[model samples]
Target: MKNVGVDGSTTLKVYESRGGYVAARKALAMDTNAVVEEVKKANLRGRGGAGFPAGVKWGFLPKDRTTTLLCVNADESEPPTFCNRVLMEHDPHQLIEGTIIAAYATRSQVAYIYMRGEFHEQFHVLQKAIDEAYEAGYLGKKVLGTDYALECYIHRGAGAYVCGEETGLIESLEGKRGQPRIKPPFPAIEGLFRRPTVVNNVETLSCLPHIMERGADWFTGIGPPHSAGPKLFCVSGPVNKPGCYEAAMDITVRELIERDDMGGGMLSGRKVKAVFPGGLSMGVLTVDELDMKMDFEDPRNYSLLGLGTAAAVVVDDATDIRLVLRNVARFYGTESCGQCTQCREGTSWMQRIAQRIESGAGRMEDLDLLLETARNMGMMPGLSICGLSDGATYPIETIVKKFRPELEAAIRSQPAGQVEAVLQAAN
Candidate 1:
């Protein structure tokens, strides 16, 4: 990422000089099935929170379909997930080349980079790169003198967090409100413009160039089995040096936070209290659990939602988990699309309960009520339209469950009259 500075590295000449676009050219020359097979063998999973195998997703496209579309999800709206944005800013050509390779593999004729509208700087950077690619025969009809042709465009989103959801992104791209559509007819079957579409994250696509250049075996050998390859993790919050760092997936959560070259340990000379191994969607892990690996499966072992976006948010010992819960609850509550009653109403309730608790007005039963509300709004189908509500539930549920004693102590310390006023205010 340092290669990108005020001097600029956003041109085709700088990119090609660094052996860029070669992978896209090579991919364009191979059979589409061959490219897809390589990616599948490499086991590249989506980095956009879902952890779905990218190659497997591509394989789901109906072979009979004529207009397969590839949508590069550049909407990095999730809190503390600047990994995608960083990649796009530092290496726009890498993403562009990967987009072309993915489009070729999916037999997609048209590609759209569904970018977050708030990323005005990145939008212009990518736009300049795309124009350079087109002028140099890397995009547009007959790319690189081959009969294969592809058209790419950028569609900016209106800064909706729901748009980070693939289906929601598709809707936004189609000039509709950013709301997730019901599944069963997944994006691979019916997506943007009602055509077969494959939505992939910017980081996921950015890996394609290196995967093609070095071969699938090399890619698979980078980390532990099932979670191979290098991953970009955005480490933020209370750390001496919180930023994006790329490492093998096998790196433990502790290493990522304490390593001098990574997060550089906690600020204020404080000890670690907890860490969100993934982004906000994943539940927080106590300092004792820091030894846990930062893989797709390890998070499940810690009883967290899957490694969603692998952006580790660290909290120092001085921080209160109640404040954490309240902050997260407010984020989800504000971002809820209101398409589902359970999510809309449940998130609001969770926010109120968390705020009340943080405000020293929590009742003893409020903890049970919080857990009950989370259970009711679980990620299970028929509960919510999308995973937003489920993401909202993780922090509140996990924090309350894991740190009940601390919360209980806080509640007990509040004056009885103050607590009564809180109840009256709610009523």
Candidate 2:
């Protein structure tokens, strides 16, 4: 965020003037194991919704493998989440430099940045930065004058939200359908053409250069011990100043919404009705639950699927909760790869039921049915290939459970014809 909005920040020359690539150069000179160990001590968690420790994930690779690949997941697919694009457009070199260091540390001979097809502008900017790094000997054979050879390329995804899953990304990279595979032989063991692979998102990789430049202990000291470090948060939906922000994980959901420098409070001074605290997938936080911390662990306490992407979408009292439920349900239904029957039918069923409820054609029993369907959708034992269906579950489950009265009232009062006026007033 420091380089954001600065003139020529995306250019190699300007980035070099600010001592960019210093960490990559330093990392190139250190032992690979040492680099991994330093990151482990930093407690840096993946920013790609999972919040898994990046260093621990790296250590999962087999020691005997000769060829390893590092993938940068630039597919920012979570709804209303575009913070990853901010780093790509404003400070691409930081992400590129971090990619170089991460690939080297993971002993990856090749690296690919899996970008979403929608990111036309970010793709060009990041590609330009990669070209500059290659010309500077910071990438390609003999990185930074060291013996470490790394080849990094940008691979464009065909707009599949499920590709945000690592296995799905790998399958797409292999020229196959973008769908996730089962675990046990995770990406660390058999990934990307059946070789050991590491997949970290743009924000997670971007933290690598910083960890290399500054000691790991410095990162560990930032926030909570388990989920420490600088965090990028995007606040949206009717906030006075909705935008991408960077801060330590110590910030609360309420602060992220009401902070003058961040969200600047809700628009038109409306009270907050609810918030999708961690994108649409993690779960919803009612107005009374706004005090929840944005760290990776706290969301779990509130039945969220972890601090997913740290992108918070606020819902003011003016909006209807059923609309949110229907929208997300429809999204997961449309986006599900139809790989798993439960996920495929489950998302569609939830979407249809939500639409019915919103249209005032729902029965009283429909609320409980929605809850049951969502609870068992993606989390069934040995059923779901990935957590995509689970993503659909949390938002629907939370909204129905936490705000049942609101949804129930809408169901009973909305007489199908009144649905039009509700939509019109919202618009």
Instruction: Say which candidate scores most in lDDT.
Output: 2
Worst 10 residues of 1 by lDDT: 1-10
Clashes of each: 0, 0
| Candidate 2 lDDT over residue span 328-365, tens digit each | 88999899999998899999999988887776666678
The regions of model 1 sitting more than 4 angstroms off are 1-7
Query: What's each prediction's TM-score?
Result: 0.97, 0.96
Tens digits of lDDT, candidate 1, 1-427: 2234434567778888888888888898899999999999999999899999999999999989999999999999888889988888878998999999999999999999999989989989899999998998889998888988999999998879999999999989989899999996999999989999999999999999999999999989999989989899889988899999988989999899889999998898999887888888788898789999988898888889889999988888888778988998999889999999998999999998889889988889999999999888866866677899889888778888888888888888888798889778878
Q: lDDT per model, in order? A: 0.89, 0.90
Model 1: number of clashes? Answer: 0
**Model 1 lDDT at residue 70:** 92
